[model samples]
Target: MSGHLDYEINKELGECYLFMGELDKAEQYYTKAASSNGVHADPYLGLAAIAIHRGELEGALNMYQKAHKVDPTDKTHAGIALVLMEQGRGADAFGHFVEALKVNPENMVALFSLVRLGHELNRLDEVVPHLSRYLEIDPGKSEVRYSLAGCLVCLERKDEARAELNRVLEGNPDFEPAKELLAQL
Candidate 1:
């Protein structure tokens, strides 16, 4: 069989084992897949996931870096950002999340993380645009709309915040948080 075919088979096996919670089996197949092909990032991503599951943060970071080097995709950037967040490197994680969003604007994980990190770091200005984009993609998410309203309130954009709160209340009339926020506004 061709090396690429072998790599695909090994990678599939690794994923199956990982899904079944067989870490050792998954690791073995993932390692085999990594050696089977020198170009694809899936094996490294799989290994990174295993490392994360095992609490080997440094190993997971290294594996994610390797995956990113191979394929600089949004998934790799998001993985690195998540690991950085776990390490308490919020600033660094924020940057990676931004990169992930730039690479794929529809990346909800990156968007949500960026919004959360932005709020925690008091960078509401940076978060507003992303939150708006998220709402565009998922208008039914009342909680996100509520969060956007809270961020707007912090920015003193009362009119915009009130609009968002109204939207949330319209979607879910019993959403007390939105009702409270609207009343405050």
Candidate 2:
């Protein structure tokens, strides 16, 4: 119980430091947290964040993978995918991002990264459903709606794209991209 408490306190401190952009302090606390409770993934995730901030992609990937091994949470998968993407392994990262989304459909990091990768991979068709799911949860997100519309346009489903763009314009009239897309459609 004491060890669990120690882990919790250290992990929280790590998160606070990370949020404050004190990467060194955060890493120290995260390391302590990991020592206190090896089963928890948060510490490794925090460590991975620090590694990424320091531009140590290999170390970040290792930490992320360690977290995933401890607990295959959405954050761990996303973190691993992010590091892999940075290492110019987008093809490999794509599967991990998809796994992250599957674990938590609302993971915006995984969702947005997948969208960006979809374009690079020319897998717009695969990204459409993920974008649609995100929009269902966050209907007010004009950017996500715009992305969905863009995907539809690329898929040669201009009618569907027009409908999505119209919805975006309805919610945010000043959205230039939506207006331009709507006009083009």
- Give the top-scoring candidate (TM-score): 2
Counted clashes in each candidate structure: 0, 0
Given candidate 2, what's the lDDT at residue 117?
96
lDDT of 1 by residue, 6-46 (tens): 99999999999999999999999999999885688999999
lDDT for model 1: 0.91
Candidate 2, 33-126: lDDT as tens digits: 9988448888998899899889999999999999899899889889989988998999999999999998898898999999999999999898
lDDT of each: 0.91, 0.91
- TM of each candidate vs. truth: 0.91, 0.92
lDDT of 1 at 129: 82
Q: What's the lDDT for residue 169 in model 2?
A: 86
Clashing residue pairs found in predicted model 1: none
